[model samples]
Target: MLDNGNVVWDHSEPRRGANDGTSYLCHGHLARLREIVATTPKAVAWMREQLEPVKGDFEKTAPMKASSKLPISAAAVDAADETLGLLCSWAEYTAESIGQPAPDMSNTWKVLASADSTDGALRVQGMRSDGIATVDSVARWMLERIDVIATHEWVEDFTSELCDQRATNLARWPYEERPKPAKGIECPDCGHTTLVVFTPAFAPKYSTEPLLRNGKPVEVTETVNVYDRVINPGGSVSRSSRLVKRTKRYADGSPVLATVQRLNYAPPLLVQCRSSTCRAVVRESDWARMILQAG
Candidate 1:
């Protein structure tokens, strides 16, 4: 028995010796005790029972295929199970406390921070998690829940699991900062509007910072690239590109970093597209107002 939160079986084959017993290798979360338990394993036994039901449910509903990626569903808590009760209660409590929509795919769980009415003393009064606990007094709340403590012996791993997922989220997008237009960042010389990217204040439940799922690590991605071509009246140097996958913050939100990435966006022109046959360029605001319509 490994004390860390991770659980794995020491049995190399499907069938072991008649006397092998169900003693599997297990690792607990960081907060879990470090000793390897050789006794009738609590976590391993619980996991075997828990997974059988979960796996059956997925097979019936989400049916896994060899090539298709299996989608993660919210952990199904048995209504009568006390541990699930604790996990659920905490989920609701944290949700309400988080007050923001949800974590970004980057696992960067955003909080609903209020601007200080007077001096910027932390005005966090919402029901967020203990990780972002502005008030240190209640930090042990995750462990304090009766619902969690009543669950399987592996419950202590929640903190480690939660933190690991959050770290994976950071790896997906480490550069998270409010978008601040440069000091002299006026509109470009073009009559066409320039686009400014931003991260929004709202979050959705689907936004999660995950550590790992189904034996795979999740990594968030953002990409951007451009040829710095200053458009003047002379022969214009233009480029054509395939659309690059981008982490599109809400079109109606605040902006973030402006970094170069590998992309195929059409090189934007600095001035109005004056081509007589080309009706591409329009008013800057109008250009910004256009939307990409799906065929």
Candidate 2:
């Protein structure tokens, strides 16, 4: 558990007796890259707009003051220009990687990379020099665009690819004895037969409630319950549960009818092999077939 009360999986500890083979792309890594790819172009455009007025001020012989002082300083203008250039280069790189024609960013990348070392400082100067209202608008626009990209449907393709790669690699491991949920299985790295088990503690369930705008029911939203049970080799068990809510809204900001919940149980849990020297984890279905020969 984190200090913020969020439960996070700690994968930092190296697995005992694990293979020191070539590294592979995992789901988390791919998702992060996708976010950067999707948001860079939008961020670049937004930063350019915010810096346009400042650039105009810089070009003038006398710094143009808005109300009391100059709208933007020379340093702030330089920093914004550098940031925009870097973002343009990133956008072009991502476009090419996704099979799209790269944007013309030769001039953008030609700019020196050392113009601004701190993005936060540039933003602060921008906000202080140019009114706070303009800075807030740009900040909100950038955040909304990033949020849309983070939750976009295209992420599923990246996740599927990661899962497929993992399955293929795990298939190459040689097991001493077949794994089973009932009798347990031996660790692939170590010869230990003891393993920690994990199973669904509760059947999945959901409930819907009508959302109201004013006095009328606009739409229905559904909340689902997910539960998991983790059992150690010593028979000690722990459970975790969470409630997830799904909502939909129309373009006018009115709630829409609820959509059917799509339950995803990918990369199903595997028992944690309890060998101090070799803690190998295998897929639940694979272990069951290996031990019970269950179809």
RMSD of each: 26.8, 24.4
TM-score against native, each model? 0.18, 0.21
Question: Distance from true position, residue 49, model 1, in Å?
Answer: 42
* Residues 41-60 of candidate 2: C-alpha lDDT, one tens digit per residue: 23333333332233444465
Show model 2 residue runs off by greater than 4 Å.
Answer: 1-25, 37-69, 91-100, 104-295
- lDDT per residue, candidate 1, 89-183, as tens digits? 44445545535332121211234445855554444232223211111111223322322332333433544444453344335323342232222
**Best candidate per lDDT, number?**
2
Score candidate 1 by lDDT: 0.30
Alpha carbon deviation, residue 30, candidate 2 (Å): 3.1
lDDT of each: 0.30, 0.39
Candidate 2, RMSD to the unseen true structure: 24.4
lDDT of 2: 0.39
